[model samples]
Target: MKKYIKPYYYYYYYYYFYMAEKIGIRTATIVIKDNRLLLVNSKYSDGDYYLFPGGGLESNETIEEGAIRETLEETGVEIKIEKLIHINEFIYSNDWNKRSLTIFFLAKPISIRKNNLTDDGGKIKQVEWVDISKLDEIDIRPRILADILMKAKGDFDTISLNHSVDYKHES
Candidate 1:
């Protein structure tokens, strides 16, 4: 005799496996000068929240290549990645359900030009150099991103920044 499985059970099983198999990779840069960090205010869904200039890695792209592409795309500044800063992981259960692996790197700006940046959806936004001392006042993503910056100032090798991707979401 064959056993019958419920449709909802199959649906939940597929959902779990789908979430587990889906993986996202991103690259971000730390561009600092004097005592300020270069950040961009995204005008998209997370408007007002400050974040480093970088984005998801395209298919068949190296982490470094994605970093360069994203930095140049987000900010009008060309950058040269210097060293690996930290690897961050975040999970969200909102519209897009999955986890993301963000690779942060320390980089220097090679050149800057007059231009503007927009999200993949064409949301024009402003970019600014934020003083590290005032980091506490701004609403930033991956909250721990700030802590990582502070730790980097010292001699910390690796930091386990635990945070939810959709911490800003009201679910």
Candidate 2:
């Protein structure tokens, strides 16, 4: 007998309750300080990966509020959201049911917690500040995001990804 394994997204989509029409709204915070970007190393079923500090939005919180909250929870750092940088539509062309929209915000840290880390459903391994220039060397979710951020020149651009980034701006 062959053992069957479900994809990571399947477990996520099936377990979480979306507030609106099965469309999930996620917020990510991009905090850079001293030429370093804040990122969380997390473990998934497939493997470990790095992502910005963020998570799904709650019912009562505004987008900015949610972003701030999620960032603090995941990174143990208090942040002030500066502005919206990227809006990503991560919808699967083949699976409409597994659709999510992610809003990325540029943020600045206000306070830092020493040795304090919040549990992202027990998935987060550690939070670290990675040098901005070295972002390409790691595995980041929504892979194209690393490329876009690496080349971004203060101009905000929206990215729509069915399976890849569609908008590319060269500075």
Candidate 3:
């Protein structure tokens, strides 16, 4: 007679959740402090909007690595990842289907150099540090990116993603 082995039923559920968590939308944001926060003005289908100096994470790269690489590539500034401030989930279905899970981190600028890299085959129009005090003057992506920075207190803090949406139709 052969020995019989039974598998635990909970294992399947656990694995499913783990995989979902791993692949559940991913993005990164880097905050480089000068007198202001480092922001990138990039072309969007709907005119232009501002965002931090980070983007989607490439395969095999950790979030920190991605943040550093993206920031360097976008702004030509090497940055040290300080702490994660917030994790946001963005969902929008309009002109195009889009969904993202973003990781926002507080970073310190290590060096400043000119960036020759460009996105979408065009030169990056502008890379500038805006005063943190003037955050309201710019159109920031996810909006909460700025809010968390203003609210961060001590080191290594985490916050749930909270964003309010208003309906606006663009032609």
Please name the candidate that would achieve the greatest lDDT relative to the true structure: 2
Q: In candidate 3, what are the lDDT values of residues 1-171, reduced to their tens digit?
A: 223222444666666665343423354555645557788876665667777777777889898898888888888888888777777755444413344566777788888877545453443467888877677777777676666565553334555665432343210
Compose the digit string of candidate 1's lDDT tens values, residues 34-110: 77888877665656577888888889999999998888888887888887877777776664666778888888888
lDDT by residue (1-171, candidate 2, tens digit) is 223355656666666755334666889988989878899888877778898888888999999999998888778899998888777776555544555788888899999974566655788888899987898899887667777778874445564342432332110
Residue 17 error for model 3, in Å? 17
Q: lDDT-based ranking, best first?
A: 2, 1, 3
In model 2, which regions exceed 4 Å deviation? 1-21, 153-171
Off by over 4 Å in 1: 1-20, 95-97, 116-119, 122-124, 154-171
Poorest 10 consecutive residues of model 1 by lDDT? 162-171
lDDT of each: 0.74, 0.76, 0.65
Residue-level error in angstroms, candidate 2, position 132: 1.0
